[model samples]
Target: MNEPTLPTLHWTRRALLATGTAGALSLLLPPVAAAAPEEMDAAIREMFGNGTIREGRVSVKLPPIAENGNSVAIDISVESPMTEDNHVRRIGIFSPRNPIATIAEFHLGPAAGLAQVSTRVRLAGTQSLRVIAEMNDGSLWSGKASTYVTLAACVIG
Candidate 1:
C-alpha cells in the first residue's frame, strides 16, 4: 500500500495578523518591572505626604520564616479605641520585593471596632513587610516584620 504525504501548511494573513498585532500592542504598553526600594519610598511619600510617621501601638504578627512565599498569613493589630474621637482610619501594607510595592491598602472607620485585620499576602522572597496605620488625628504609625521565605512565589523559574 502506498502512503499519502500531506503538504506543509502555510500561515495565511489572517493567522499571522493576530501575532503581529499582539506584538505591536505589547510594545506600546509599559514594561512591568518588579517594585524597587526607591519606588517603595515614593509610594510611601505619596501616601503620607509630609505626615509624621510615629512608631508605637502598631504590631504585625506573622511567621518569622515562611516555608512558602505564596499566601503568607498575616495579622495586623493597632491599639486604637475605635471611638469616634480616636480611631484607625487606614492601613497600608508595603512589600518591597513584590511586583508592586504596595501590597494592600485598607480603609477603616470608627465603626470597624478592634482596629485589627488579618489577611494573606504573596511574598516574592525574603523581605520586610511594612505597615503604616493612619489614625483619625492625621497621625501615621508604622511597623515592620521580617520574613524569610524558603520558596519564591512571584518569580518564575
Candidate 2:
C-alpha cells in the first residue's frame, strides 16, 4: 500500500531575496528621532498659514517646574471680546520637543463667552510651550512659557 504523500512547502528565490534585503536594511537604518523645532514650525505654519504671529493678547500658565511630565497642568487664556464681530476662533497649544509638537487645539465661538482652556498634557521633556490664539479677524496672537520637567513622558522605543 502506498503511503499518503505529505504536503510540500515552497519558497520562491525572489521572495527569499526580498525578505533578506528588508531585514538587512532594517538593521542598517537608525531609529526615527523625536520631534524637533522644525516640526513645530511646520505645524504652526500649517495652522496659521504664514500669518504674522504677534506676541500679546495671550497668556499661558504652567508650573515653572513639573515633578512629572506625564500629567502637567496647563492653562491658556486669550484676550478677546468674545462677540460675533470679534472673538477668538481657535487656540493651539504647542510643545517643540514633544513627540507631537501640537499638543492640543480648542475651537470657540462668540457663544463660548470666554477664550480660555485648561487641561493636562504630556511633555517629552523640558521644553518651551507656546500658545497661539487665532482671532476671527484672521490675526494671530501668541504666548510662550518654559518648564523644567524632572521626569519626561512620551518615550518611544
Candidate 3:
C-alpha cells in the first residue's frame, strides 16, 4: 500500500492581500498612547516629590533633527565635583510625546567621576525632552530641548 502524502500550504493573491491589510491595521494601534504634557509633569513631580526644577548646571545635547527616530543619541553632563560633599545623585531623562514619558534614570556615585551620561533613546515624534539631575545637596537641575524627528518610530495619536 502507498503512504499518504501531506498537504502543502500555498499563498494565494487574496490571502497575501488579507495578511498585508492586517499588518497595516496593527501598526495603526500602538501598545500605549503617547503621554500628555500634564501626565509627564505629574510623573516627574511624583518622582522628585514636588521639588523646584531649575535650569542650567545640567547640559543636554541632542541634534535638532533626527534622521531616524529609533535611535536618537543623547548626552547629559552636570556641573558637579563628583565628591562626597558635592556629587550627582541621579539623572532622569523624560520624553513628553513618548508612550512612556520616563525614558531612563541613571544613578551615580563618586566612583563615576565627572557627572556625565550618554545613551540613545527612541522618540515617537517631535517633542520637548527634559533631563533632570539631582545633586547630593538635595538640589535639582534640569535642561530641556526640542527635537524634530524626520521619521517616526512609534505610532502616535
Off by over 4 Å in 1: 1-34
Error of 3 at 71 (Å): 0.5
- Return the TM-score for each candidate structure: 0.76, 0.77, 0.77
Candidate order (lDDT): 2, 3, 1
Model 2 vs. true fold: TM: 0.77
lDDT of 1 at 104: 84
Ranking by TM-score: 2, 3, 1
Local lDDT at 149 for model 3: 93
Better of 1 and 2 by TM-score: 2
In candidate 2, what are the lDDT values of residues 1-157, reduced to their tens digit? Answer: 4653532323465677889999889768652335788989889888878999999999999899988889999988899989999999989988788867788888899999998889998887888899999999999999988899888875421
Q: lDDT per residue, candidate 1, 21-71, as tens digits?
A: 988897686433357878787788788777888888889988989888887
**After aligning candidate 2 to the native by TM-score, how far in Å is the CA of 148 from where it should be?**
0.4
Worst-scoring 10-residue span by lDDT in model 2 = 3-12
True lDDT of residue 10, candidate 1: 38
After the best TM-score superposition of candidate 1, give how far the Cα of residue 34 lies from its true spot, in angstroms. Answer: 4.2
Give the C-alpha lDDT of model 2: 0.85
